[model samples]
Target: MIMPQQSSKNSGLWQQATLLPIALVAIEILVINGGMILDMTTSGTSDATRVLLMDSPHWFLLTGLVLGASEILAYRFLVKRFAKRPVTELGATGCIKETALGILVGSVLVSLPMLILWARGFWRFNSFAINSGILKGIGIGLIACVFEELLMRGVFLRLLEQKWGAPGALVVTSLVFGAIHLSNPGVTWLGALTIGVEAGFLLGTAYLWKRRLWFPIGLHFGWNAMQAAFWGGNVSGTGKQSGLLDGTLHGPTWLTGGSVGIEGSLLTAVIGLLAAGVIWKLTPREAPEMAPHEAKTPTDEVPDTGETPAITASEPGRQTRRD
Candidate 1:
């Protein structure tokens, strides 16, 4: 794309502007997390503390992570501020509520068909009532929730929503989030769709409600820790995790999700729906819009990135200078 004078001027400024917070975050993660990794390895704790655990430190670690990731502060300083496009309480709140409700409804919608199939003797639901260790279970669930939510919900979703508007940003991010998880171990089409949309609902709710990374980060971390570590059920059907349960599931793939994990199971869809519904209840009837920033650019030359590129008279790519 071509550039305007102002955008050209701003590049040097914005480049550093953007990188500032990112650099700080990178440094912090590497330093703090790196130390944690080191401590675990050196003190013979690596097998346990290397990954997240359902324990006190894990909770603090997740919380510290968000504090370290407050790039929005950097955003305010670097970008020129702007305003909303005439937002309403319904648009924002409804979008959030509907996002959660839609997930809940959609999850149930998908699972119900499968449940009927199981009942009709075509298949069976395989989930077993098992008990993993308490601390161990919590740890596993927390890690899953925290890491996935932090990366997808906290990082990607926020950035997309910032530029693409809430609807476009949230949907695309959710899809991407689900697609990425497909790489795990036993990701099936059903599981991917179920968890992806379900994840979207949970994270989307946090985004709209808190407008901060901490809540989603903490919630994601906590849930996963509980699910995988506490119950010892294979998370998403990948494999036997070293969780509290330390056992294998039996029955039809649908019931137990055989190795593709629960995300692909009918029960997962049902659970996701119920969870989304609960989120909908918690969300407010009214919500606030994202704050605005300046718009700079020549109409014809704005970069394809959702952001509107702006420039100044003195910049190298200035229309006047280029022409």
Candidate 2:
């Protein structure tokens, strides 16, 4: 009988990682059940209420917003309870800038493979048009990203990083990400495996490197938006709307990604892996050090002891009090 080694590091990793999937399921259940109830009450129909509440652009946007808000609140609450510092590390304040960067990175990376396929005669662009639906797509993209990123990167990867380090966290998060998509329409073992290899690592690393949700959230949103809403490609085989550039894949299914879309192609996997490598290199070798006692916001300096603070961060050259 071999006894398992009782290393603290491995123990910590398992503990933290274990909590992530459970937490994710809880959040999804709350959101889905809550959304269903809201829909049935408002629409006076419980038949297929889940679909009725979540099957449109407006619903996507609304659900994303609601989920995003809940995620933020939950994150802050968890951090306050479990971690030693404030929730500023999540980049809640610099959201707009981080999201913009994520969108840019995600769009460029996701498009590169498509462009290559098109140039190589493996894919073709046919009907091209921009319409009102694009707006809905963008909205859906923004909100949907918030929910996914909040779970995968912001919660799961972030917590895992504290215990397993970046490499381990990246691997775990990516595998889980891909596994969850197995239930999506038209997904094969190859498709699921490639998705794990291509997107799981990329998105997880984005969060690991940045230590912020915005970058990965943006990337997640931008990738789907470009693939499904822009190129009219199938997204995880769920089908997409007639997008800005309706196209057809002309070559082998291996190259063209078949019905599962570009993400299923080996080309996408290679490109995504390369992009992940670049992101890893660009990310700090180690996390930036937080001050022993630091302020999360300017208002954090205000004294609550019935005394006016002498110097706020607003005051020039004022030294913060040390703990």
Alpha-carbon local distance difference test for all models: 0.51, 0.73
RMSD of 2: 10.8
Best by TM-score: 2
The lDDT of model 1 is: 0.51
Residues 21-101, candidate 2, lDDT per residue (tens digit)? Answer: 466557767875676567657766665765754665666656656666776677666555444356664655888988889
TM-score for candidate 1, residues paired by index? 0.51
Instruction: Report the lDDT tens digits of candidate 1 across residue range 250-284.
Output: 56766546566555565665665566667657766
Clashes of each: 43, 0
Q: Highest lDDT, which number?
A: 2
Off by over 4 Å in 1: 1-144, 242-248, 277-323
TM-score for all models, in order of appearance: 0.51, 0.75
